[model samples]
Target: MAGRIAAVSIVEAIAADLRNRIFTGDLVSGQTLTETDVASTYEVARPTAKASIEKLVAEGLLDRGTHKTARVIELGPESVRDIYLARAYLESEVLRRLARDKAVPGDAVLANSEIAALQSGAPLDVVEPDMRFHLSLIDAVGNERISRMYRSLVGEVRMCMVRVQSLHLLDNALIHNEHQRILELIESGQGDAAAQLLDEHLGRARERLVAAMGGTAGPEAALPSTLD
Candidate 1:
């Protein structure tokens, strides 16, 4: 039992390192990963390396097929569009509810502050705070189903964000300002306006990210009209 526990811990540590590397662009999208390569690099057993790769695959950070080597996820046009659409829908409702109730989430405010502080940090460093801010908004509504649905999309969203940052499509100051503005709108009890702004914010990001990925004939091709 103890040996199994220790092995699980080691797998987690190695997986975490690889996950960060992927997020930071140390391992680019579609880069292959093999158990032998990971084992040699980390000086771990092949089983341990395999477990780590599997873990990442399950998290949607890596893609693997039966008898195929794992590779970092590469988001295409359709996937990016679908993800952003889902996020916009889910978060738009959350923003509307919070605005109607005039209930601001302190955690979201704190996460936005953290985002402001990390303006000069590596692109990946801002991803957590960005996610936290959105998640806090969802949690504020106290809807378990909505929370779970949003959580399911987080892994893919982070990957998209990594692409957005790597391509220099995101401006830290702009992000912070947009988030703060949404919070203010909610506090002022402007539910429809807050939701509209949230939709627009997500739509702009989706269009840019999809464009950067070389996807679709145009931004309007894949994105919903509301986002435009």
Candidate 2:
């Protein structure tokens, strides 16, 4: 039992480390991972490393081979578009429901908190909080299935964000302003307008990520990876 627990811990640790590398783009798409290399680096056994890689493969963040080889899954244009499409559908539904039902009395408070956290120039836990904010809306809809799927999708989205190295806290005056506006629309029961604003906001964010990754943008253009 002790050995099993230890093995699970090792595998989870390795999985998290590799996930971070993949998210930060340090392990780019198509980069192969060898069990031998990972075992040596993480000081774990080959089986443990294999387990870690397999976990990520199941998460759709890594691709596995017939043998024990694994590689980071690359996001092509279509994959990117599909991701946004899923997000748009889910978020728009949540927003529409919230506006119609007037659920979640603290919309303004949550939005203000997020904006203040972003503007404070402090390292924001953007990924987790972003997931929470969106999920909160889905939960308000009282749909178990949609919420479950949204949670699953959030994991994939986070993986993509990590792959693009786009979760850092930075000063995007425009983003801050945009977020504020969306919050205002939601608060005022303008579901349609809020949904439109969210779509545009997410689109701009995606564009900035692509531009930053392609080296078309300046240093401040890319999202930072560090929590702080």
Candidate 3:
């Protein structure tokens, strides 16, 4: 039992480090990882390294082809559009609910503060905080299923952010301002307006990312315009 526990811990630790490497672009998209290479680098058994890679694969970060080697998943234009569209739909509903209930998410405010603190030019620095702010808004809805669905897409979301930043396409100050405005609109009980702004905010980011990835933005998909 003790050995099993220790092995699980080691797997988790290795997985965490590999996850960070993917997020920080140390492991670029389409780069393959062999179990042997990971075992040698981390000084772990091949099975342990395999388990770590499998964990990331389950999280949607790593893709294992038929050959069973893991490679970082690429976020092409279609992927970028779908991810942002899903996020916009999910978060738009959350905003409407929060607005109707007049519930303000404090964690979102804290995340915005973190975003504000970063230097304006460092787009990568704000990605996690920006993601946190949106996650906080969804969590504020207090629906476990909805939050789970949203989180399932987060790995791809972070990958998209990394690409967006690398292309120098994000504006830190603008994001902060937009986040603050969305919160204020929710606070004022303006559900529809808040949802609209949230949709527009996400839509712009999605289109820009799609365009940067060499894809044309399609017609806007409609979200629920009002709370149920």
Candidate 4:
């Protein structure tokens, strides 16, 4: 049992590393990965490398092909649309509930602090605080099931965002402005309006990212055929 658990942890760690590479565009869409290469790169056993690749396949980040090859999964237009729609639905509802219940009374203050942190030249990770802000809103909704789903989906969402950031397509200022608007709406007790704004903000962000990636509107389009 302990051995199995250790193997699982190792697999998960390799999966995370591969996911980061894919997200950062270091591994482009349809790029083939061999177990041998992965084992060498990660300094793990071949079986462990295989397990890691399989895990990414399960996460929709890779595809297993014939000849014992694993290729990065290509996200098409439909996937992009679906992801954005999911974000809009989940985040908007969370904001609405927070406003209606006055659950996030300190939202403005928190958001402003996030903005300040971003402006402090801390790091790209620090600049991407919108996810945390949205998660706080999710917590306010008080739904364990929804929260679980949100947690599961967040990795994919962050992967997509990382690609957008790599392309320099995402505007931090615009994001900060949207957050401020949402917070103001929530603080003013306009739950419905806040929800609507959240939807529009996310929708526009998706559209802009798609446009920046040459109007492909998908992960494949966002990624190059090969990494530089």
Candidate 5:
């Protein structure tokens, strides 16, 4: 039993390493990962390397080709659109509920702190405060299920932020202003208006990114069941 647990831990470590490489663009889209390379690089057995590859595949960080080789999955336009659209749709609800039922003072205090930090010259790449600001809004709804759903999207969301930053396309001031505006609307009990602003904010970001990436998938397809 201890051996099995130890093996799982090793595989998880390998997966974590490869995952970082993928998200950081060290191992880019469609790059193949052979089991031999994994074993030699990580000094693990073949089975361990294979397990690591499978773990990454499950996380959508890699894909298996017809020849059964693991390759990094490309973040296509469709995927990007789906990520942002769903986020906007669901997050608008968080803001909407915040307008109707959520307490304003606590969330406003937290959001204002983030805005102040941005005003004080904090870099946008430092996403901790940014994440906290947005997450606090979602969390204010007091729905564990909705919050849990947003948690699942964090990885992709961060991926987009990092990629945009790398491409020199991220607008720090724009994002800050938009977030400040949304928070203001929410605290003012303008739920519908806040939701509209949130939708436009996410929509424009998605359109800008997908257009830059050459996606023609009509911006977004059907939403996942989580949206419903």
Candidate 6:
């Protein structure tokens, strides 16, 4: 039991290191990872490296198949459009419900902190704070079904964010202010308005992502949110 626990710890550490690389763009999308390479690089046993890869695979950070090494997720424009549409629908409802109930998010401070970090250009995981903010919204609702569904979709969301950042589609100020608007609307108890703004905010991002990928804009990406 002790040996298994120790091995798990090692796997977590290695996986964290790799995960950070992926988050910060050191490891680009579609990069391949192999147990042998990880083991040699980290000076750990092959089994340990394999365990780490499996962990990342479960997190949706890596995709492993029967005969191929795991690769970082590479999403196309259509996928981005689909995922953000789902997020916009689900997360806006979370805000609307909370707004209607007059309930404050316990993690609101942390979510605001992320926006501040983006505004200040603080050194961060680059995409982690954004993920945390969205996930917090779903988790705070205390619904297992919604939380599980959101969690499962986070990996793809992360990919979309990476592309957004890399393309500089929306500047820090845009992202920060949009988040602030969402919070303000929720605080003012305007549930439907908040939901609409949230939809438009995500829709702008979706359109930018699709355009960056050389794809056509879908109906859901038709919001006119200004990025400048």
Q: Name the candidate that leads on lDDT.
A: 1
Over 67-159, each residue of candidate 1 has an lDDT whose tens digit, in order, gives 999999888878898999988898888888898889999999999999898737667778889889999999999989999988878878988
Candidates' C-alpha lDDT:
0.85, 0.67, 0.85, 0.71, 0.72, 0.79
Clashing pairs in 2: 23-162, 23-163, 168-224
List the pairs of residues colliding in candidate 3: none
RMSD of 6: 2.6
lDDT of 5: 0.72
Candidate 6: where is the Cα deviation over 4 Å? Answer: 117-126, 218-228
- 215 in model 6: Cα distance from truth in Å? 1.3
lDDT of 3 by residue, 1-228 (tens): 999999999999999999889988899889999899999999999999999999999889999977777999988888888898888888888899999989999999999999888875544587889889999999999999999999998888888887777776656777788788889999999988888878777776777788887888654322222221
For candidate 3, give the lDDT of residue 179: 88
**Candidate 3 Cα errors over 4 Å, as ranges:** 120-123, 217-228
Clashing pairs in 6: none
Q: Evaluate residue 50 in candidate 3 and report its C-alpha lDDT on the 0 to 100 scale.
A: 95
Better candidate number, 2 or 6, judged by lDDT: 6
- Runs in model 4 with CA error above 4 Å? 65-68, 105-112, 119-128, 216-228
Model 1: which residue pairs collide?
none
TM-score of each: 0.86, 0.72, 0.90, 0.78, 0.74, 0.86
lDDT per residue as tens, model 2, 107-139 = 445744674565332222455455555666677
List, residue by residue over 109-152, the lDDT tens digit for candidate 5: 56546655563332333455566677778777778999889877
Whose TM-score is greatest here? 3
TM-score comparison, 5 vs 6, better candidate: 6
The CA lDDT at 152 in model 2 is: 62
- Comparing 2 and 4 on lDDT, the stronger one: 4
